[model samples]
Target: MIEEIRIENLGVIAGARVELGAGLTAITGETGAGKTMLLTGLGLLLGGRADAAVVRAGATSASAEGVFLVEPGSPAAERALEAGAELDDGALTALRTVAAAGRSRAFLGGRTVPQSVLAELAEHLVTVHGQADQVRLRSAARQRSALDAFAGPTHGRLLEDYRAAWTERQRLTVELAELVDSAQERVREAELLRLGLVEVERVDPQPGEDLELAQEAERLGHAEDLRQAAQVAHDALMGTDDAQAPPGAAALTDLARRTLEVVARHDEALGALAGRLADVGYVLDDLAADLARYADEVQADPGRLAAVQDRRAALGTLTRAHGGTVDDVLAWASTAGLRLVELEQGDDRTAELRARLEDLTGDLQALADQISSGRAEAAERLGAAVTQELAGLAMASATFSVRLTPTPELGPWGAEDVEMLLAAHAGAPVLPLGQGASGGELSRVMLAIEVALATAPSSARPPTFVFDEVDAGVGGRAAVEVGRRLAELARGGAQVLVVTHLAQVAAFADRHVVVAKTEGDVVTTTDVRVVAGPERVAELARMLSGQEDSATALQHAAELLERSAVGR
Candidate 1:
């Protein structure tokens, strides 16, 4: 519910504030006293289109601010919190500003927000019914929406089930058609994979075999050169053909060790040096044996070398076509094998999808039937409830009915077409609501429907309702009945604000606000003030007889107020 509204530089309302609460709050003023400006401010708060012309002259911009008491954990609070907005003391502040240059801005809970966010929040916060809304109610789509809202959860659940089945059937049909259309492409892909797999299997390359073969081929190609080098090294280390080779290195080291051992009794340092030479002689002997073994093993074999080179060339083909190495190529072959299976079974998969599509089609038809039945049942109860409400609104002989005509083709909603028709009086032929009801009757019918929807067990009633001049053509007892119903609707815990010129309707408000305008030489300003007690009675007197000081008008206004208070 809106706790307060502060508007500046909007229309004739230079600066004004309105305090609201749960129950009926009526806005009244002279026709040109800026009564509509109050509703305009509300419209701006709800993300309505911003008009530069509405900005007061000489003002840079016009702004409207509202403080709403949001229920904890409600959708309104959640949306505000999602936008990084803080809920202070369980109240959300929404503000909208329209500059004279046509720029518009919206703020929610102290955070700048898109105008659309305000609109999304408004869906759950308030429902505004004005003279224009009645025209909208005449539409077929609107009629369907009202009926569906009245139908409650049973119709809602059935509609959802039908839409789900319909969506799945559409998906399956599309997939099956795509598979059939791309049959040739699938076959081409399968054949490519088949040929690649065959070549990889035939060669059967080993992991890292290419690197091993390259090293072996290099060794075999230089076998003779390696043998010659090893023989020269062996001769130098052991004994050569020439005897004057200084007895090779090993004999010299052994002679040095014997010389040191003979002098060991004379010097201890000499004995240590002789021990190091003995160790060197053993290492030289081991090196000579290894060189001889290497020279014997190094033999050239052209046949084996050529076979290794040929196998390497074959493995290179697979690597270059598929990957950089043998292992990478093998990995590709493994994945391709799985894909080959899917491509080969394309026809089987297509058949499976077709069967699924057929099954979904049947399921969708059944669900559509259920939805149609639910709507049909709801249409009867909704018509009776609304007609009963209309009788109380001073249309005693009027009758309302909902007609559901089944169509051959199914739709997302159902196979039934919903239409609301009315009989204005006895012996009158039923006609569409737009053609049968006059402007005043239309107002009453819409009010009845709104009340019914608001009171529905399944409906999440909006916290506020703004009715702008909805009682345009209504007067006398009809106007009083409208007031009574508005008060009744408010008693159910909603903040109802009705903008009306009738004193009867205004008397029913728990709080009354009057917009008074004063025309100055260069500027006109309007202020909204809360009226009560004798002040409210005077305002109502002006509404009754265009004379606030008249004794008779005062008496009538007081009587109306007393009657409304007693009725409540």
Candidate 2:
């Protein structure tokens, strides 16, 4: 619900503030007293297109701000919070400014925001209807939604189930298409993986086998040189059997140790030197044995070297194809093997998906049928109810109906397109809403539809409803009915503001605001104020006649107010 509206530099409004609350509010004034400007300001707050021409003369800019009371966890409140807006105790402030130079800006709940954000939030906040601002229920989709909402909670659940099935069917259809389209590609991929795995298994390379084989091959390639070197070193370490041969390293070290031992009886330092020489002698003996064994073991085998080289060449092929090393080749082979299995299962998976899709198709058809049935039943009742409302709104001869046209194929909404049709009077052909009524009739038609929908058990109502001269061509008893219905709509916990010139309609408002124009030396300004008692009577009197001081008009206005109060 809107708590207040503030306007500045907008047309003849200059600066004005209108405090609003629950129930019906009537804005009435003289022909040029700026009543339209109030609704235009409201349009700005609703994120309507900004025009620099609407700014007051000599003013730099025009601004409109609205304070709305929203539920704490409602979608509008959540959206404002998401945009980093700070709501003051569940009251959201929406402001729009248009500069004379054509620049425009919007703010929501104290935070600057994109104009589209305000438009999006408006869906949950207000519904505006007028000769030029018929925004709600303008499309087939929205009409279908409104009808579905009127169908009650059971039908709503059925629609939800159908939607869920439709979503799943769409997902499955896309998945199946992908699998079928990529069938040939998967076959090619599987063949490549199979060939790579075959090569790896044929080589049978083990982890670290390539490096070990390379080392063995290197030793075998130079076996003769290695054996000769080892034999020479062995002979030097251990003395040769020939008596003329010089003493080997072990024998020389042992001789030095004995020499030191004899002299060490007189010196402790010499004894330590002898112990070191003894340790060196033991190391030389061990080295001579190891060298002799190495020389014997180091025999050149051409056949073994050839076999090792062949194995290395085969493993090299595997490494080059799959990886850089024997271990990497093995790892790649393991992963490829798994992929090959998955690729081989593609046909089976495709068959399963086809079967599941077929089943889902059947399910979707049944659900669509059920939804269409429910909609058809609801459409009849809704049409009758709205037609009944039109009679009271002075369209007694009119006939209204909801037409459901079946589509050739299923759509997101269902198997049918929902449209509202109207015939202006008896013997007239029924036509779509906009084509069948005049601007004034269309506004009444919209109002009747709203009142009819409000009677539905599951209808979701917007917080505020704005009607701009919806009573334009309506008068007499019909005008009182229009006022009664507007008040009735507001009584259902909605804030309704109607721009009206009819004293009959304005008299029924819970709060009546009169826009009074004041002429100054250089400029004309309009002041807006809530009127009651004599002031309200005078305003209604002015509406009934051209003169507020006319006693007959005053009496008539007073009687109309009394009648409205009793009807309320």
Candidate 3:
């Protein structure tokens, strides 16, 4: 239940705070008095699209904030938790803001959140029965939902369980269907993959082989260049000037030996330097010998280079298509090979998969059958109850029913569609609600369902009922009946709000707000005041006779309030 709403710089509403209460509360005003602004503020708080135009002309931004007294396990609380926001059942506040740039922000229970979450939370908090809302009832989807809601708890749960099975089977069906959808394409892909695997297997490229081969080919391609470089280095280490000498007996070795001998006769620092030089000389002698052997091995080989080049080029082509590295290509081939084996098992695997599909389908069909049976039983009870409510709403001779029929195809919602059918008077066959009822008749029909569904003990989540102009085009006994029923719904602890011009409707409200507007160059602003005692009677008199000052109108307003109290 919304406990209060505060608005600042929102359209024509400069700054207003209205404290709402439990039970039926009505917001009434003269035309152009900005009562609709209250509803507009609600829409934004509930994640409606924001625009700079909604901001008051002289103001920089607009803000809407409200306090919602919540139940412990209400859908609104669950939505808040789902959004990574806390739900303080101790006190829950829903807030929204629109900046001059038209960007919007939302908050739930003091935690900043996304607009969608705020909207979802709002869904269970309030139901606005505005003019546009009437159009929404036209869709087949909405019709189906309303009928299901009317069908009550057992029917709803059965549908849920049935749809769960239906959903899982559908996922399997889609996966299996993908395999069937591309049979010809699969054959082509499988053939290509098989060819790739065969090629890689026959050639058998090894990982890291490319680097090793490139190094080898570089030497083989420029053998003379390598040999010259190695020979120059070996000669320099052994002494290059007309001396035939083993490297161990060459000049660098002799110089180090002589230096060490001199240092032995000198100080400690010279001896350490000489020892380091001697170690370097010994290392060079070993390296020269290795260089000579390496020189002997280096030689050009055109045929071997061509074979390596051709194989490397072939592997390169495979790398471009399959993977950049040999290991990656190999892994890809391995996976493709496994899948090919399965796809190649052909009809056997297909038949096995199809059999599982058939089993799931059979289970879903059985659940659907049970769901259909349960829905039929629930729908009858719901239809009769709604029919009885309609009788009080001035359609005494109306008939109502739910049409739940099965189809060949199953959807996320299950196999059958539920529709509402109604007849406004006797001797008329029941037709779809949108077709069989007039504008005013439709309003009453909706109210009847809302009032009925509000008190349904099995409703998983029931929104506060709102009846807008339900008393429109109806009066006398019919209008009084509407008031009585609304009062009853309020008595049931469902927060009920109505917007009506009739005193009958206004008298039913436990609390009433009257909206007054002033005219100026820009159409000044609106004032909303909660009325009671004499103030309420005056407002009701204005509503009843359009002239509150008249004596008869005041008496009539008093009688209406008195009778409503007695009726309660």
Candidate 4:
């Protein structure tokens, strides 16, 4: 509930503070006395869009602040707390400011916050209805929502379930479609993977096999040249059996050693030289034996060379397609093998998804049927209730109906479209609300619908309700009924604020506030104050007639107030 509202520099409302409490509070003023500004201020506090043009002339900024009282653990309080707002004894302060330069800011519980936070809190705190809403009620979607709201909490839960199932069904439908549409593509992909795997398996390339084979092939190809080189070196190191061959290194070395040995008995230095020559002859003998063994082992084998080349060519085929090396090809095979397993299971996966989608489709159909049934039942009750209310609001002959037309397919809300229809009088053909009802009838119809919805067993009423001239085209007894219903709504444990021009409605209020305007040379200012006793009557009289002092108007205003008191 809103405890108080303070507005400054907004429109012609330079500065005004209005205190509010339980029950009905009526706000009234002359045509241009800034009554609309009061609601605009409230809208700002409720996080409505801000226009710099609303700022008072010569003022730098305009601001609206509201103090709201909420239950300790209410959703509104919890949301405020979540925004780092400090509630003072269950009272939360919301402030909005619009600078003349077009910038806007919002503050909640003394902390700066985005304007959306204020909007979120407003949903739990209050419900504001205006003439604009009466126009909105003509929409089919809006009618459906209103009917759903009146269907009680059980229906609401069922509707939520239906929506959840509907959402899941939609997702499953898309996925199943994709899988089915790409079936042939998936088959082709699996075939390609299978062929690649077969090719790799036939080659059977091992890690580093290509490199090893290359080295072996090179040695085999040069076998004859290697053998010839080894034979020539061996003949040079040791004397060959051929007589034409000159004395080899070994023969020369042995002769030098004997010459040194003969001189060793005559000189000690000659004996050391003979020992070095003997070591050289031993090294030459070892080299010659090694060279002879190498020449005999080096034999060209064409069959082995051809086999190595063939193996290399086979490994090369795998390399060119998959990688630059045999090891790379092996790595590719390992990854492709895993992917092949997945591709091979596509049919199984497709079957599984189709089965799940079938089950989900059945579930959705069941939920939609339940929702349609609930809506049909609730629509009848709500239509009857609102029609009953319309009778009291001076439309005794009018018939209100909530018509549910079955749709070809299920919608987000249900399997039908809801529309509100009305018959203005007996014998008049029933038409949609927008087409059949006049402005006055529409206003009454909107009020009657509100009253009917408020009486729903499972509907949770907001702490506060603001009606901005919802009685726009209503007057006479119809206007009085409007006030009576608003008062009853307030008396049922909620605060009701009605901005009205009708004196009958003003008379029904527990409190009356008048916005008086003062025109200055440079600017216009509005003063908002609560009126009671004769002052309130005078205000009502002024609303009834052009003069507050008119004797007949005052008498009528007093009589209306008396009747309202008795009715209350």
Which candidate has the highest TM-score of all?
3
lDDT of each: 0.88, 0.87, 0.77, 0.88
Mark the regions of model 3 whose C-alpha exceeds 4 Å error after superposition.
78-89, 210-288, 291-349, 461-463, 519-526
Residue range with the least summed lDDT across 10 consecutive positions in model 2: 518-527
Per-residue CA lDDT of candidate 3, range 29-123, in tens?
Answer: 77666777777777787778888898988787899988777777667777777776665644577789999888888887777888878767667
lDDT by residue for model 2 (1-568), tens: 8999898889888888899989999999888788889889988888799999999889999999999999999988998888888899989999999999999999998889999888888888898878654445567877888788778778888888888888988998898899899999999999999888878877788899999999999999999999999999988988899899998888888999999999999999999999999999889988998999999999999999999999999999998888899999999988998889988998998999899988977887888898899899999999998899888887899998999999998887788999989998898889987787876577678788877766676766667999889887677887888998899889988889999999989998999988877874111233688999999999999999979999999999999999899999
Residue 184 displacement (Å), model 1: 3.5
The local distance difference test score of model 4 is 0.88
- Residue 178's C-alpha lDDT in candidate 2? 93
Question: Which regions of candidate 2 are displaced past 4 Å?
Answer: 2-18, 27-136, 228-292, 466-481, 499-505, 513-528, 537-563
Ranking by lDDT: 4, 1, 2, 3
Instruction: Pull out the clashing pairs in model 1.
Output: none
Best of the two (3, 4) by TM-score: 3
Prediction 2 TM-score vs. true: 0.76
